[model samples]
Target: MTCDEQTFTMKPGEFQALGTGEIAYVKPMTSDDLTTLFPQAPRMRPGLNLWVLLNADGTPIMLSDSRETALANAAEHQLHTVALH
Candidate 1:
């Protein structure tokens, strides 16, 4: 450690709460992954590319064929998006 270096610690709960409502996650998905992550989604053709906007806690908010649409939806809901992987 150096004089200019600093460290901050947070409890597990606090860390998890960091982006409760203000942040969301954007994940790219294949049709195969859709059924598992979004059971409510309508059946679609196999091997389709898709994007999903999820809350900070991994709850699906919206699904779209276009990543832009997912991101736009997140912004519409006042959420900042982050890449999941």
Candidate 2:
């Protein structure tokens, strides 16, 4: 098989090649996008901070922050903190 076929054989969590974090074009994200974005959003509670991995439209791609905020955000299911470039 080709290189792609070989690489695809790896497990989900297994390390892959470069160019992994690539996405298509889209508009800026808004609060509306949050609903669909973070189905199980981690709510950032008081004294806690949640760092969001945002897309091109400012939508949170990943919902994981410091441990301090994890519990709070997870409990409340809050979608906050957009990652910086």
Candidate 3:
């Protein structure tokens, strides 16, 4: 017996909007990366570790020094969190 496989595809925009406001991700970042990823963030000393919560489309939601806080923020917004790597 042989099994059949399913195929799926999406337009670039659709793919990027897959989760949209429904899902978010927590990313571990350094102060050095904040300027690029979250430009509005205030300047901070380099080498400090931080956690950032971002929307599915890579928009910054909030930044924190604790991953738990980031996740809590996601929960507060009713957004599901996705693990990276």
What C-alpha lDDT do the candidate models reach, one value each?
Answer: 0.87, 0.41, 0.92
CA RMSD of each candidate after superposition? 2.6, 11.7, 2.3
Clashing pairs in 2: 29-57, 42-73, 43-73, 43-78
Enumerate residue pairs that collide in model 3: none
Judged by whole-model lDDT over C-alpha atoms, candidate 1 comes out at 0.87
Model 3 residue 65 distance off true place after TM-score fit, in angstroms: 0.8
Determine which window of 10 residues in candidate 2 has minimal summed lDDT: 18-27
Strongest candidate by TM-score: 3
lDDT of each residue in 1-85, candidate 1, tens digit only: 9999999999988887788789998888899889898887788888999988888877788889999999899999999987655
What TM-scores do the predictions have? 0.76, 0.28, 0.86
Query: Judged by lDDT against the true structure, how good is candidate 3?
Result: 0.92
- Comparing candidate 1 with candidate 3, which one achieves the higher lDDT? 3
Ranking by TM-score: 3, 1, 2
Alpha-carbon deviation at 6 in model 3, angstroms: 6.9
Which of the predicted structures, 1 or 2, would earn the higher TM-score when compared with the native?
Answer: 1
